[model samples]
Target: MRKDKITSDELARLCGVSQGTIDRALNNRPGISPKTKQKVLQMAKDHGFIKNQYASSLSRGTSNLIGVVMLNLKNEFFSQLLTSIESTARSFGYTTAIMLSDNLEQVERQCVETLVGMNAAGILLCSVIPDPAYGKQLLQYSTSLVSLGNHICGEIPHIGIDDCAAMFDSTRYVLRHSYDHIYYVSPVLSRSSKENIDAQTQRFKGFEKAMALQPSVHYTVLRDPDTYQSILKSIPANGGRSAVICSSDSYTIQCLQLFKNSDVGIMGFDNPTMLRRLYPQLSTISYPIDAIGQLAVKTVLSPVKEQKSHYLAHTLISGTTIK
Candidate 1:
């Protein structure tokens, strides 16, 4: 049979099995021997047989596609999360359909409508908008919905790190190292819209609370547009030990380069690879990216229950940057 024309019948013939047996094995239906199933699957793989998921879904009245909606992929953290979510979903015999909202509520709504219209099996959303009303409207589409990172809708199951606690710990870690000044630098909190403000706000609140406990320690928040220049000037002129808690790894790396010759302590979030290489000794708060992805899929597929949120823990990884 021609490569492009290879069908289930051709695969069955090559495997010395009936078409019925091939169907059962390929679809993972019971009643087929393990040996026969393996042989059929191997033959299908060798022949480059690609199952038509859309056609199969149409026949079964349910799609195996899991829809994922999140903010922009400019941040390495979100990109890593998307990769983990896709890989985890595929391991369970499901495919992913991804959409980006660029932190716009309207764009996020449009993505949701499109996924709903396509009858996606479930949706894993790192919601740009934190509006419960919009989330309620999404529930009318009849697909399982799970929130990632941010709790956009209170009713939906959410999987995320506790931003407040994570930041609070990070702040205290830096403080304990004899840093007299703490600078919380976050571009998002300064410029993001309401749809993208939840996580940043929580982190800021955590940083504030930690600073409040140490009244003698000087602290300042540097938003975007001016943060870079401000850090460059402040760290050197402060005349004392100072530390910067960057909102993300990208920002942390940027600050690291700026302070490469200075003695400023730096801490970053998400622990990206670039940060690891640039400053393997950089302190960071590690988010459970893989666990978040796996749990998001699990929550969507599991039966509905009282569990509305799953806040995974974050770890404070110490390095030379903090000391």
Candidate 2:
């Protein structure tokens, strides 16, 4: 049974309650009785009504829809963002529609358009679209939009850490030690291809800037996706204290699998929760997920969008992986 087959009034009628009671029960409002709430939920389930936010939006009202667009939810960091964003949005009396771009331009654009068509009150985007023109076009759209992470969308104000500074500091951490060689791992960026996220570029800029101060230090940029694994493997692990700094924890997790307890030290950004179990000793930067996600919802739902990008502080965790 589809959700549309059962309206709020129909469910309320079957449950022997007013539509108001059903609304409170559906939204989990405190005014509803526990027994009534359970009854309503069971009825909803038995009838095959969807329990997703999209289904919730019907009862809450379409005007309260908050659309969230993300690059992908394959990693712990972004998944954390989803949980935080949805929780925060719900607290603000809004229902969210989460969509994925899979790092594709066409898909991301389609997602934005779909939300716009749905009359979303606002959109929170962590985009993979490579063009700034689309962002400028978004500026003219009727709905409010706030970039969640990347800063590439036409001077869009994004909620992100000082990526350059974060990487710069991470690089310096390895540099502070006697490490003779450093290799920075990042997804390759192709402007013509639009295959990568610019947020990765900002991190690289930071690493590059920090590396510039120490010309004597041997540093290599492994930004090519296809070649980084082979190139990283070919390098002699036994050489003078070498460190490989990964741009993301997802990539670092792979490196952790590849290197295990080798002499080559590994460092990753945003120590993902799963990584903690897999490699407790891996050093990483811990960015504030709660702060970033809450702020993203606030900025996107505001009457006026934020003009300047916001930066939050990040924590560096030192683990035994570097030693």
Number of the predicted model whose lDDT against the real structure is largest: 1
8-90 in candidate 2: lDDT tens per residue? Answer: 66787899999778778877778987998999999988776554555554544456789998888888899988899999999
Per-model RMSD to reference:
3.1, 4.9
Local error of candidate 1 at residue 243 (angstroms):
1.3
Q: Can you write out model 1's per-residue Cα lDDT over 63-151, one digit (the tens) per residue?
A: 88999998888887888888888998999888899999887888888998888877788888877775558767866666889888677
Clashes of each: 0, 0
The 10 consecutive residues of candidate 1 with the worst lDDT sum are 225-234
Q: Candidates' TM-scores?
A: 0.86, 0.79
lDDT of 1 at 98: 96
lDDT of 2 at 162: 88
Indicate the TM-score of model 1.
0.86
Worst 10 residues of 2 by lDDT: 187-196
